[model samples]
Structure formats: structure tokens, C-alpha cells
Target: MRISLSTLGCPDWDLDTICTTAADNGFDGVDFRGYREEIDVTQHPQFTDRLVETMARLADAGLTVSGLSTSIRICFADKREENLAEARRYIPLAHELGVDTIRVFGVGDAEEHSLEELARVGGETVRDILALDGAADLRWLVETHDNWTSSADCRLLLDELPDDNTGILWDVGHTTRLGGESPAETLDAIGDRIEYVHVKDAVYAPDDENAKDDGWVFVLPGEGELPIDDALRELDDRGYDGWVVHEHEKRWQPYVADPEVAYPAFAEWYRTVLE
Candidate 1:
């Protein structure tokens, strides 16, 4: 499995710094979640107007643009047009950058809508986005997050979009810690549809100031209780050869360890354990 790092970890790093750090640290690819203070790559000048230069820079650094991580939530009722527009905007950019996958989410809240409703909305949105031009060349991945963390719940959305171009971004941390599903069970349910993987580690710490509502605090890989090894073993057993992205979410949870420290640690651990 190839290892990649998400820009979500280095919100403070500019494009040059990002590519240099990724290359120097032995990352095979760089997943763009954000750059500097901008959260949307589509709106970022480096991607929109200066794409050729950006691609050249990455090539010079010996890194590939693994994927573009977008905040397009398909399961929300009020964001249908917004989400579709976001997908339409990114498809061509992804094609230009030679990226085959773009990460999206099914961010449904159970209190706001039933699982069935979320599935219906998310399915329709994804279908519409997939129908757009240039979308067929790229994979649109729905991550295991929010109400769709459970493999069973994720299956509802996956069943609706049977297109081969649409697949799951299996976030092992969410499935194990949040959805209460083992790596084996999650793989059993949606392993065939997984096109990408987001690897992170955390422990239940309600008392910690940085703890999310689930009482989980992000930690460097191999430093917490996420079943990362088991998940990687399962992926290996299945002959999965996709990118294993280290999703250090320092963009959202600022109190976590700096990316400068956490990113290299993950690279070393990943090589030691999986390479």
C-alpha cells in the first residue's frame, strides 16, 4: 500500500512547503484538503488559475496529487444544488491534476433525518453529480462519517449508486471508534467498494480539552487505540493496493500535535508496520 498525507494536517503550510515536506518525508502522494488558510482547493489560486505550475511543482517534488478532499455533503436536504455544483466544479480540476478520486461525505445527523431519508437524499445527490461531464473519469468517494459511519448505514448509500466510479473512502477510525464496528466486519460489508482509506488514531478521552463530542482525541498513528494494524492487515489480505492516507485533522482540532511532528511520525510508523 502507498502512503499519503492529507493537507488537512498542515493548514498553515503553503504549496511549496507542503510538497517539499511531503517529498522529504517519503510520502508517495499528497491529498489536498486545504492549503494555508483556505479550506476549498477549487477556490484556491494554486489549483484554479495556476494548476499547471502547481502540478509541475508536485512533479518536481516527486509526489502525486493523491486526491482532492472536498466538503461536499450529499446527505443534507438544503445543500442539494450546492453539493452538485461543488462536484461539477471539481471534476475537471481532478481530471487536470491526474487525480482519480475526490472525497465527499454523507454528513447526516440522525436527529435531523432518518437513515432512510439521508440515504435517499445522498443517493440522489451523488447520482446527479456522477451524471455530470468528466465525473466518469474520477471516483467520487463517500467517507465513513457522521450518520454513515456504520457499514450497514453506508451500505444504504452505496446500494443506491451502483456505478463503478462511485466508491467508499473507508475511514477505519470512525468505523471502529465511532460506529462500534470491527475492521473485519466493516471489510466484510463494504470492502469491495473501498477505493481509498483514511487512517487516523485516537483514544476515548472525555476529560481532554481537545476531545470531540464522541470523547475522542486525535493522536499520532500507533499512539492510540484505533485498530490501524488490523485494518491494514485486512486490506492486505484483500489485495488492496490503494493509497493509505494519514488524515491528521489538525485543521479542525487545533490543539493536537503539530503536523511537522505528527506527519513524519506516521510515515515512520507506517513503514515500520506495513512496509
Candidate 2:
């Protein structure tokens, strides 16, 4: 399996810093969630007019562009145009960077609409995007997040989609801690469709008011309570050779361990797993 660093881990780092740091830390690739202060990297210059320069920088460091995480909400029918517009902008960028996988959000709130309704709308919206020219060349993985953390609930959306080209970004932390799924159980439901993965770990701090999923706080990989090794084992046994990205999420939680600390920590943990 290939290991990569999500730029979510280092929100403040520029392209050069990202490439050098990732190569130094033993990462195979860098997944662009954003660059520097810009969260929507499609609009960023590194991905636009200067894309060739960016690609050369990554290649010089023996890195690939693993994935791109976008804020496009696939399940929200109300923002259909916004979602399609986002797709139009990034589809070409994806092709130029040789990044075949991208992350989108299928995060539908149960309060806003029924699962069936969300799935129906999401299916239509995603199909529309996929039908666009050059879109079929790339895979769009809807992140396992928000109200759609549970793989079973996620199936309602996944089933509506076509094939492997559209799937889930199985965030182990959310599915296990928030969705209450064992790794085996999650694979049982959507293993075939898991084109990419986000590797995060957290401790169950049920009393900490600021913690997510009722106190499951994000921590450096292998340091917190989540089943880092078991999850990797399950993926290996199932023949998942896709990118397993260390999503440190410093963009959202600025107080967490810095990428310099967290990225190598994840790499060291993966080495132990291989042993």
C-alpha cells in the first residue's frame, strides 16, 4: 500500500515545504486538501497557471499527487450548481496533476432530509458531474463524515452511484469512533468501493466538551486509542492497495501536533505495521 500525507496536516506549509517535508518523512505522495491559507486548492496558483512547475517539484522529490480533497458536497441537491461548478474547475486540474482520486462530501444531515431523499438527490447530482467531459477519468470518493459516518448509512448513497469510480474515503476515526463500526464490519459493507483511505486516530475522551463524536479527540497516529494496526491489517487482508493518507487535520484543529511531528509519527507507525 502507498502512504501519503494530506495537506490538511500542514495548513501553513507552502508547496516546497510540503514536498521536502513529505520526502524527508518517507511519504510516497502528497494529497492536496489545500495549500498555505487557501482551502480550495483548485483556485490556488500552484494548481492553476503554474501546475507544471508544481508537478515538477513533486517529481523532483520522488512524490506523486495522491489525492485532492474538495469541499464539494455531493449529497446536497440544493447546491447542485455550486457542486457542478466546483467539478468543472477541478476536473482539468486533476488530469494535469495525474491525480486520479479526489474527496467529496456526501455529508447529508438526517434532520434536513431523509436518507432516501438524500441518496436519490446525491445520485442524480453525482451522475451529472460524472457525465461531464473528462470527469469519468477520475475517481471521486465521498468522505465518511458528518451524519454519513456509518458505512451502512453510507451505502444508501454508494448504492445509488455507478461503480468503483465513485466511492467512499473511509476515515477510520469517524467510522470507528463516531459511527461505532469495527474495521472488519466497515470493510464487510463497503470494502470493494473503498478507492482511498484517510488514516486518523483518536482517544475516547467522553467528558471533554470540545472533543468530537462526544469526546473522541484527534491525536497523532498510533498515539490515541483507535485501532491503527487492526485497520491496516483488515485492508491488507482484503487486498486494498490504495493510498492510506495520514490526515492530521491541523487545518481544523490548529492545536494538534504539527505535521513535522505527526507525519513522521504516522510513517514510523506504518513501518512497525509492516514488520
Q: State which candidate has the highest lDDT.
A: 1
Clashes of 2: 0
Q: For model 1, how does the per-residue alpha-carbon lDDT over 4-112 read when each residue is reduced to its tens digit?
A: 9999999988888888889888999999998877888888888888988999999999999899999999888789889988888888889898999999988876797
Tell me, what's the RMSD of every candidate? Answer: 1.3, 1.3
**Lowest-lDDT window of 10 residues in candidate 2?**
208-217
Model 1 / residue 203 / CA error / Å: 1.7
Instruction: Please report, in order, the local distance difference test score of every candidate based on alpha carbons.
Output: 0.89, 0.88
lDDT of 1: 0.89
Taking all chains together, each candidate's TM-score versus the true structure is: 0.96, 0.96
**Model 2 lDDT on a 0 to 1 scale:** 0.88
- lDDT, model 1, position 87: 87
lDDT of 2 by residue, 66-100 (tens): 99889998878889999999999889988988888
